[model samples]
Target: MRADRLVSLVLLLRQHGRLSATALARELEVSTRTVLRDIEALSAAGVPVYAERGRHGGFVLLPGFRTELTGLNPDEALALLVAGSRRGAQAFGLGSALASAMLKVVDALPESYRATAAGAAERLLIDPETDLLSRRLAAEEVPDAIAAEVLRAVFAGHKLRIHYAAAADASPEWRTVDPIGLVTVRDRGYLLATRSGADRTYRLSRILAAEELPEPAQRPDRVDLDRAWQERSTRFRSGGDQVTVLLRLDPARREELAGTALAVHAEKRDTDGWLRMEASFQDGRHAVWALWQLGLAAEALDPPWLRTALHDRATALATRYGTPS
Candidate 1:
């Protein structure tokens, strides 16, 4: 019970910032006397603990008091590392920083436990290609410390000043904005926000820097990020932009299309021979790019516009360097 109380105290202090002895005792299912003794034990053991009295305060640690992870067993260490990795990389926490911190934790463990951690990493390897674990991230881009801090600022309702780079230019321009939420679309990470009364998405890769404001931000009352995303997509799709796309495929490509995001929904259209696809997109331009990704199999099927666009593109290429006569 005392050890549980001690662990509870540490976790509570970590999560809740500070807690009065009464609150800690209530949470730990122990008496105030036990909590006081446990706190004394923690402080005596060089936990750098502090206490605050009066109505507005409680037990507090120095702001830099970091919890050590030396005492964990093998399974515990593995689970902790995996969870921390997912949080840092996927959930917008400190990717490299948390990874660095995890290395430190692993180093602090006993030699045998360190081996166990290494074994865990090797055994529990995550293949992002098949599992889609890496889908939420950009291609070959991981959330760095700056992006993680930006996410923190957003979640904490803090405004941000970011140095953003444009696709055309090498120099970064500074802009002050309130971050709304993060979205991962088509394996690319994006930060959605309103800057200068117009909604925009700034790619995480294009953000050069971000600093949080001391003043709070105005968070949306209804945080329907999905709805905002859908609205943006609907506007793009409804603008009479059609792609007369074609797929000249083998069996594998067809099967993959049905199973993957290429299709909105998949149904078996007859048994063996060939599958007819009703592929649609926002416009021919975007559709051209998407079709290009399918390599030889995809081609223009109908709609005069797509054929014209493709023909114009081909002619321009030929004119630029002379056609193969």
Candidate 2:
């Protein structure tokens, strides 16, 4: 761990040119005294690290010093190159940073593996603008200023004030929240925060504006964001108005039904070679809508309301098309 910390210290200086002990302590999650000790150790080990004494003075390396820390193998290099190609970083306003980091990684890689890894990464497409069906996959546009403020609050453990556009309201409402973390899933970004001690996840794209407050965040010193996100997801999936329907469907349509259903409680083959499934939906309307899409391949066996809705829809369609007009 000490070795890793020393390497990180060197890389930080290399990347930022110079940094005060306070800044280094904050970035390394250590203390100023620890940073000073590490600086002395680096100097003792002939790392060419020097300190300046002045109002703006800090630790810096000799002008021509660079670390030989490119320890990645071919596969690791390719994995990083592929990760750099993803569009998810754009949601957090790190697209340019990712590009610069990738260039540095490539430059540091062994010359024999660098070109091959980059060429392979280019051939593997991710989140393409247009898919085979000609459907476009687009990422939400988050304003640079808003994203910067959100990031500042998250990293500095400060509170944030945001003007959020709720779907039910016509105008955006201002709310002060303690940002726990920022998450980017696919091409969308979400800010996981707590308002009045209740957990909330806000889409970054829907945040019309944001401001980082000077007040420290009211949250646990250490947060398990992944577990918190999972708990919230479980609550959302189970808290909705859910309805279950029994259906007999063609075996070939099993995937279609499963894809549309919230959950499949049971599945078994009937005596007539049809697959019977008990599936849950968001509500009766959702069940009816999904069944309608299957047409003749699926039949709603129970929950007479769902069957009636499907029958009504089929009758209306037949009446309209069977007319002499």
Candidate 3:
């Protein structure tokens, strides 16, 4: 761990030119004394590290000094390159930083592996703006200033005031929340926060405006964001006015139905090679809509209302097409 810290210290100086012991301690999550000791050690090891004693003085390396510490294997280099290719980083306002980091990684890589990794990365595509069907993926617009403030509050462990536009509401509402962390999933960003001790997840794009408050956040010093997110997701999936539907579908169409259903309760294949599944939906309309998308491949087996709805839809389609007897 100390070795990693020392490398990080060197990299930080290399990137920023000069940084004070206080700033170094904060960045490395150590004490000023520890930073001083590390600085002494680096200088002693003939690293050409020098310190200046003045109001603006700190540690600086000799001009044009660089380290040859690129110890990453080919696989590691490729993984970093692939990660840099993702659009998810754009949601957090870290696109430039990710680009800069990737450039540094490529420059530091072994000559033989560098061109190979770059060529392989070019062949992979992720989350294209438009698919073959011409359907576009939703990319929310988060203002740079708003994203910066949200990040500051999350990293600094402070409360945040945000003007949020809830989907059901026409106007944005202002609320002060204790930010736990920031998460980017797929191509969207969300702020995991709490208001009056109740957990809340704010879609970053829906946040019309934000302010990093001066007050300290009221949250546990240590939080498991993944577990918390999972708990909330579970509650959301189960808490609605859910309705279950029994379906008799072709085995090939099972995935089509399951994908649209909120939850699949059970599935079994009959002797005739048909699949019967029980699935949950938000309500009757939701169940009917999903089954309708499957067309003739799926049939509603139970809940008279669902079957009636499908029959009505089918009848309307037949009437519109005017099929011959």
Candidate 4:
């Protein structure tokens, strides 16, 4: 076990760059003395490991000391490659680099292991097209990256210089702002921030540029994201523009509702081995979608207007599916 630990220690130093004896001891669950002993053992075995004294010093491998990855068995090499490949690193502009590293690891394998790795590689398939699209999306290819960066800065409490295209404003305008956070609805992302002047939600897709200020000051600790989300949601639910609808859901439907963000607006009860729930939604749009998905499990609780609206929508859909009369 001690000998195996020595090998593991060497690998850690080689892979993770450097670590203090205390760090190594904690990782290996051994005493600092034991870590030193292992380092001596490694040195005795012609492994180049050394330590520096004082602050900013720790265990370091001699430059150019390489651990042979081919030392891994065929099964191990294949597993390593598969794991690396699964990280979608290629889509994130890291595929070639990872692929190169995998090649080096595979080259270190013995002939039998090489054959196994080859077989696994044949079975391993990287979905190039899907990964490309996913990577592109994640890398801010669709939305303006500068806008996203500004929003992120706001979330992080950093001040930003933003070139914005407002909904009402025509030309792009620049302003300095203290960002608050972002809200994502459906596929669109909105940046909720406070300009040096006021609170607003900027469409991330429309942001022209956002630059971080030097040594940006911290925002007030009073900004509570949960409180903001709740206030926004309440306004959406009770605002005169959007109709509030109540839903009476059965046990299965109630249980499902209890697991959502909207659960905050619901009241539940036990009813003869079943549960009854009342839920309020901000807009009929989402409510209607939920009703269509709930099938027969959910029923409208109140508001004659909502009932009529649902009936009319259902009838329209039914007529569309029915034979021409």
lDDT of each: 0.63, 0.81, 0.80, 0.62
State the lDDT of candidate 3 residue by residue for 151-229, as single tens digits: 8898789999999987736689999999998766767888999999998999999998999989999999998988988
Query: Mind giving the per-residue lDDT tens digits that candidate 4 earns over 1-325?
Result: 4754665677667555789999989777689999998999888989989988789799999987866632443323333543443333322222233433455565556646866876887896753434444653242222335643653576457787777777635788987777776655433456666665566567665667778776563467667776776776665556554444566666766655554424345555646544445555546675666666676776666667667777898899899989876
RMSD each, Å: 14.3, 12.8, 12.4, 16.0
User: What RMSD value applies to candidate 4?
Assistant: 16.0
Model 1, residue pairs in steric clash: 246-299, 248-297
Given candidate 4, what's the lDDT at residue 281? Answer: 54
Question: How would you order the candidates by lDDT, starting with the best?
Answer: 2, 3, 1, 4
TM-score of each: 0.52, 0.66, 0.68, 0.45
Q: What's model 4's lDDT at 269?
A: 64
- Model 4 alpha-carbon miss at residue 321, Å: 2.4
Which of the two candidates, 2 or 4, achieves a greater lDDT against the reference? 2
Give lDDT: candidate 1, residue 212: 86
Q: Whose lDDT is higher: candidate 2's or candidate 3's? A: 2
Q: In each prediction, how many residue pairs overlap at the backbone (N, C-alpha, C within less than 3 A)? A: 2, 0, 0, 3
Winner by lDDT between candidate 4 and candidate 3: 3
Residue pairs with backbone atoms closer than 3 Å in model 4 (clashes): 70-108, 70-109, 90-95
C-alpha displacement of 4 in model 3, angstroms? Answer: 25
Candidate 3, pairs of clashing residues: none
> How many clashes (backbone atoms < 3 Å, residues ≥3 apart in a chain or on different chains) does model 3 have?
0
Please tell me which predicted candidate would have the highest TM-score against the true structure: 3
